[model samples]
Structures are given as C-alpha cells and as structure tokens.
Target: MPPLSMPSIPQSAEPAASRHAAPVAKNRRGLETRERVLAVTRGLISAHGYAEVTLDQISAEAGVAKSSLLWHFGSKEMLLAEAATSLFRQIGEELGAEPHHGRTAARRLENSFDRVADYLTANPEAKGVVLALLFSGSVPASVREEIRRGWDSHVQDLVAALSAPGRPLPAPMARLMIATIHGCYCHWYASDRSEPIAAFLAPARELFADWLRSRDR
Candidate 1:
C-alpha cells in the first residue's frame, strides 16, 4: 500500500489577528502611561529642580508604578528634557501662529518678541525654568543644550521671516534683535521687581519694534 499522503496544515487567521492586536494594545497602553508620567514630571520638576526629582517620586506623584515611569522615560534626565522641549515647542507654536507668519523680517521680528512676552505672562513657571537653567549650575547639560537648540531654531525662523529677498537684514543684526528679546526676559527674571512682568516687557517691546524698523530700513 502506498504511504498515506499527509494533509497540509493551514495557517489560522486567529494567530495573525492576535499578533497584530497585541502591538496596538501595547502601544495604546504605552502612550497613556507616558502621558501620565510626563504630566507628573512637569509638575514636579517645574516646582522642584531636577536634583530633587526621582523616579519613585514621580511614580508616587503620578499614581503610576515606578516601572511604568521607567518604561516611559528610561531616566530622569530624559523626562526633564522632554518637559523643557515641550515648553519651547508650545512657545514656538504661539509665535509661529502670529500675524508675523507671512510678514517681512521686521514685522516678524516684532511679533516674535510680542508672542514670547505673552507666553511668559501666561506661563510664569517658564520664567522660573529659564532662570534655573541660567543661574542654577545643577541643571543637566542635556537640558541646557535643549534650550539652546530651541533658541537657535527660533532665531533662525525670525531671521528667515525678516530677511525676505532684497530687504533682508544682516544675520548678525537679526540675531542681535532676537538676543535683545532674550536678554529682556533674562533681566526681568533676575530683577527683584515690585512691578509686574508686563511692566518690564513694555519697554523691551518698544525697543524691539524700533530696532526692527530701523534695521529693516
């Protein structure tokens, strides 16, 4: 008798479905956990410096497991970096949305300062973070680098907007214009002012406006 032919074993769709569903489920959980961890980290690190912050503290503050926080950020430095990056990105979005979007370098330059002033007013903790980074030597180099990169990118954008075609201002002067705004904020943060932040920003705004117009001309 001939050997019986073996029947072909067909693959089940169930395994493929399970495999696909597994990653989606995991990713969704991961994103949810990450959001929670970042939320907790921002509150903690903003109120307290990085040195005082720890994974256990974040987990307890966030109501998440320590392992979960670890899975999300891998380390405390990474978490702080994300928070600072988020802050810069928020400011960038507000600045980019201004009437300066399509305007000339001069107008864009003016709007840049105006938008950042508005951001500082709304998010005063941002001022604290800036001061901490500048004055406090304890902040991680990675955090400082992140802020520097953000500042560079923001200046480049203002330059591009201000330097349109034949009317473009010199890069160094444009940078000076941008740096002036940064200096104003830094000074305000450093002062023991009895007045509101708005008061300090008023003169700086006027100065930036005049500088933009004169430089563009």
Candidate 2:
C-alpha cells in the first residue's frame, strides 16, 4: 500500500509556529516532508542513541535536501525537541485503552502507567531520546529544557487523574508516583527491559489500592 501523508496526530503534536518549534508546513508536499523527517528521526533515534543520531543522517535517510531539513526545522535540536513531544503524545494515546466510565481512578492510573512502561519497552529509539535528553547531559541546555517540557503535559494529566474524588490522591503523592514511574522507566530501559515493563508499575497500583482501602475503612 502507498504511504499515507500527514495522518492525524494528537493536537498537542502540532508543530509550533516559532523557530524553536517543529516545522509548520502549509503545502501538501511541505507537510509530507515534515512527516518524513519525523519518521526518520524516530527510527534512527530508536536504533542509535539520541546524541548519535544527527540531522545529516535524517536528511539523507528521509530523502530530503540538507537545506530542506533546515527549511522545515531551524536546527536538529528543534527537530528532536518536536520528535520527543510527538513520541510522548503517541504514548498518551496508547494509554487510553478502555472507556473512562465504570473504571476506578486507581485502575485508570494503573493502566496509564502500564501503557507508558510498555511503550518505552517497545520503542527503544524514542526511549534512547528520553534517556539522553532527560537523564544524560548530552544535549544543549536549551534542548534539555524543551525535552523537559515535552514530559510535563502527560504528567500533569496523570496528576489530574489522581485528583479525582472518592479517596482522591494528594497532589504531592501524585507527583511522587509520577517521579517514581520515571525512575523505574530509566531502570527498566537501562537493564535491557529483561522483564515485563509493567512489572515496575505494580507498586503504584498497590499504593493506589492501599489508599483506597484506607478511605473505605
């Protein structure tokens, strides 16, 4: 089958209008170019470490001119910033496995965490980007800040979920859970993900259940 051009992505994935943002293309070909660059970015970054994947390789692999790469993305840093956001948003979509109604807040949180853990296991390239940009001091400071922002939205979403009533979780605890989840993610990937990634999320689920029991008692 022929490749689809510009398939709908989450609204949060839209490229920004500013130079620091993903290239905002207007024309059909222009949009296609951006998609190709992002695909190559994800693929190569997954195969190699984030710092090792360069714009020269992305441009060559995506079949776009080096100048075209620049025309779409002001710099490689900006491209990776956008690609990280894109990958994260894709993971968010993966978390929405079931209908919200009839699901307990703890169950929902568990599912979301499980989804994130599983995603990192499956997409090692994107995981490498997370490790290099967020964990390792390999990227420029400006890019590091951008990568941090990319991680915040989903965490904020998790915080919102934790705040739901009926033994609502405290914000501090929600933040702690998310922080721990990130730590586990680092450990899981660093160890080659030998075991199921969701195994790391079991503690968060247990915590939520413990809180629920306390509230019921």
Candidate 3:
C-alpha cells in the first residue's frame, strides 16, 4: 500500500455571485484568532466530550468574544465540524508526508501501522477528541454527518491503497482495519502510557497483514 492521503471535504455549491466575487483574504491576526478558536474547541471537546462542552467555555478559554466565535464559524455545530475536519486533514497530511518502506504488501501495512502509532503517541489529544466524538450520543446530527464524511474519506483512501489489481478491498474490511487501529489506541490511552502504542497495535497489524496475504493467495 502507498502512503495514505485523505480526500478533501466536499463543499456545497455556492451562489453564482458569491463564486464570482473576490475571495477576502484574512490578515495574520484574523487567521491566528480563527486558529485559536479551533484549538480551544478541540481541547475542550477532547477533555469534556462534545455534548458537555459549551460555546461559552470555548469563548472564555480562547480569550475571544462569543460574537467572534459566531463570526468565524457561524454556529457551534459548524465550529466543531471544522475542528474535526482540521484534525483529520492534519493526520492525513502527516501520513502522506513520508513514504512507507517495505519489501511486501504485508510489510508495508505494518509500516503504516508504525507510522500511525508514532503519530498517535505524539498527539494523544487527537485520539481523545476523535474517540470522544465517536462515542458521544449528544452530537448534533449535522455535526455527526460531517464527522462521518471525514472518516469515510480516510477509509476510502486506505481501501484504495490496500487493494490489488482487479481486486478492490471490501469497504467493511477497511472499516475493520480502522476500528482495530483505534481500539489499540484506546487501550494504550487507557493504560496511561504504561505500554507503548506500538505494542498494542502489533498483534492487530500482524493479523491484518496475514489477512491481506491470504486474500492474495
């Protein structure tokens, strides 16, 4: 499999006039304020879960006014959606930055596992935010749909990379691989870093590799 690269989120069609209008570029300060709001949202969601987090808390923690938050993101749901999308995009870019090195497909899969383990280890809060969103029951349907779209994009990329000539991987198998990867991360997180994430993922990695080899045979 090649390096994993996620597809961009699909945007809705804009009005003809809006499409023709010049894009308003944000200044450095505006950009920074936007990022600060996003960062604060992610942190709060990771620590308290999406259902428990409030716009007031984010505004206070980010040192931005509530009106500014609304101005940047329009609504709470949009803010959370953008935050999750940004995290997924960041992960995809980092994964795509380095090429996987291995002699065989199975080995390449293991290499990808290593890369994920390293990334999650470095960005534990990312795992927290993702899992929190996944398990939360109170997320708005619109927000949940956005998250699903981002997740499906990631899964589609992995499935494409893992498929062989004239043989596409089943979407379910791709989902299984992703679930196992997150399961390993959950265990490692629960253990409080007592065990390395790589160790937690090793068995599942080998299992996936074996399954891939079986299909090839």
**Which model scores highest in lDDT?**
3
In the range 1-217, model 2's lDDT, one tens digit per residue, is 9887886787666455544343333466677778778878888877886778888899789998888777767778778777766766765555544566776676776666666766666665564565556555555776777767766766666655544555555657756766777677767677766687777667766776567556645
lDDT of 1 by residue, 1-217 (tens): 9999998766663577777998999999878777777667777765676558788888788788877666766656656666655665665666556664457565665566666766666555554555466455776676677667766776666655556566655667656765666677767767874566667767766776677677666
Model 3 local distance difference test score = 0.74
True-vs-predicted CA distance for residue 80, candidate 3, Å: 4.1
RMSD of 2: 12.1
Residue 111, candidate 2: Cα error in Å is 1.3
For candidate 1, what's the RMSD? 5.4
Give me the runs in candidate 3 sitting further than 4 Å from their true place. 1-65, 72-81, 93-104
- Clashing residue pairs, candidate 3? none
| Best-matching candidate per TM-score | 2
**Local error of candidate 2 at residue 162 (angstroms):** 4.1
lDDT against the true structure, per candidate, is 0.65, 0.68, 0.74
Q: Find the number of clashing residue pairs for candidate 2.
A: 1
Error of 2 at 189 (Å): 2.6
For TM-score, candidate 1 versus 3, the one ahead is 3
Candidate 2 lowest-lDDT run of ten? 17-26
Candidate rank order under TM-score: 2, 3, 1
Q: Which lDDT tens digits does candidate 3 get at residues 61-121?
A: 9999999788877778768777756765665555445454444556656767877887676
